[model samples]
Target: MRSIWAATAMTVLLAAGAAACDSSSAGPAPAGGLAGSTASSSPSATPDLEAGEELARGLDVPWGLAFLPGGDALIAERDSGRILRLRPGGGTPEQVRTVPGVAARGEGGLLGIAVSPTFSSDNLVYAYLTADADNRIIRFRLDGGDPETVFDGIASAGFHNGGRIAFGPDGMLYAGTGDAGETSTSQDPASPNGKILRLTPEGKPAPGNPTTGSPVYSLGHRNVQGLAWDADGRLFATEFGQNELDEVNLIQPGRNYGWPEVEGDGDTAGGRYTGPLVTWPVREASPSGLAISGGTAYIAALRGERLWTLPLNGDTAGEPAARLQDRYGRLRTVQVAPDGALWLTTSNTDGRGDIREGDDRILRFPAR
Candidate 1:
């Protein structure tokens, strides 16, 4: 086994031939990874965990992972504006659709994707992307059709274009938007950026929102990229902190999460703001995508180069455990497959990390 620091130091020198292996080839991964409780700030060696099977390779900045009705995966590329579909068993991914009007810039491009809950009837697929004018959510049919704009007017920038969308249990669309490098938008009620927007399938504000006739469900968020619901219908979101702490917040309608006012675990300003349930140093957890399975919340980390697991204890989150530390370069998106396996994607080719051969690949892990 190699030390995480050693692996990280040698990341740039990884052999091109090693990364050139196709998805059909099998490779041995580093063993004896490290684990620790993020809340306690302690790390220790854990058992030799399985490295999982590589599903596809040679991807270009894969960011989103959503499943079709038949269990096929639809992946969104952050820079290419292309959607690729892969089988559950692992093989070469086939291009399905190429989204138009994408303005790929710094950290901005095609981001998150979702399939309609009633795909059998409507066959609609939803996507959150950075368009030429703004960040927007669009829906199109996988069969064939021009993509229709479901919602628009969210701000976009080189960075902080929050682009994750999903459907809740109540059949409403939920989108997380970023502040677009403007600190004031996080606290502003009129701006859609830096807030969670809830809408109907037709792009109207859902009923029972915090404010009547407003799509804003929650406000005061910095840059939210991950959103998931627990078995009990609790919404958990992952937010990018400024320079110090990153956060995992339990979301509620119309709630204000301290942004410019505070970063993590700050003074709630006499209960006016809600604090995060868990916080980690930005280096340890630049968390991106989140998925909850069997009461455990799995977070995909980028700069940390690991997966963070947090157990759910009713309304509270337990200590987080790190997995695959430095085994892969940088993790971007994580999703629980329809058959209960964990699917993860690497972002080494995303321009910020060392580009290894065959980087930006997808891996499939066993069920939890």
Candidate 2:
């Protein structure tokens, strides 16, 4: 069956207007904030969305998407292990490179892609993939060379293999990993699984990390596939819950986000676990890729098949509004293009949903 609902952005925006105005629905304040400061009382305004156009069609389980300096995007296919490049205007995508030894099993495969922030000088493209032995991050150049392993040895499984990596404003590489179905790993400081790891470009633990010589930046995430930094340089992540709540968390270094121990705003009787800024029923928001623009976060939903927009004021987030509901089947990744357009990918061909004429496609929309 089709995953997303077929509704226009304006229609959903109008439908959610009432709910968006209600400050009570903004959900919990999450954990950490400036002392004695109150959350913004005014609701966040709805995004001005324009008609979307398909950028490319017929992708096979496209997972990771990154943009180069020239306005072209490099996308990764989860099962195919191929990297394809396409421009803003529609055309057949070109295969730039194919990663070798990629184990495309279950949720494992080639996942996230990132261009080195210093790409002008380094010409490096990074990828997070499930290799034969483990889930690892590797960097390679489009010009052709053996991919160099930046980091490795996270347990790999058919499911819960979180694979998203991005370079933080601090110039440190941040990776989100899953527990690989091993729940205990979420809370284990020694294990890289179920944690957001901070590492130097060469893959050593970043300086001033939460723990001395440890890459674990935050613990207790089930599966984190989306990472973005706001204008203020605060980190935000999208996490998948186990049949309960899906989360958009305001991430802080060294903070513990209750994963196996709790889901959503659960039983934080003590101040040990940080709560999510926003939570949605799992069916409504299997949120994956996230991008923030104009003080708003645009999240791509998988099972929910919609794009969720939440306004950000300071550290507090306003109520979330769903746009383009069911218009696309199974959204996977969303990124802000260099020209400020929002680029999205579909996951209908990723072993789920009803495939359409353009089963797996890349879409472009105006940035708000």
User: Candidate 2 on 1-368: residue-level lDDT in tens?
Assistant: 12232232234334443221122212111111111221111113222455576666666788999999987888898987878777666554656677887999999999999989999888999999999999999998777777899999999999999999999999999999999999999999999999999999889999999899999999999999999999899999999999889999999999999889999889875989999999999999899999988788999999999999999987899999999899888999998887677888999888878788756788877544
Question: What are the per-model C-alpha RMSD values against the true structure?
Answer: 8.9, 13.3
Question: Model 2 — which ten-residue stretch has the worst lDDT?
Answer: 27-36
Model 1 stretches with alpha carbons more than 4 Å out: 1-51
Cα displacement (angstroms), candidate 2, residue 224, comes to 0.3
Clashing pairs in 2: 4-326, 5-325, 5-326
CA displacement after TM-score superposition, residue 168 of candidate 2 (Å): 1.0
Name the regions of candidate 2 deviating beyond 4 angstroms.
Answer: 1-48
Model 2 — TM-score against the truth?
0.87
Estimate the lDDT of model 2.
0.83
**TM-score, one value per model:** 0.87, 0.87
Output the number of the lDDT-best candidate: 2
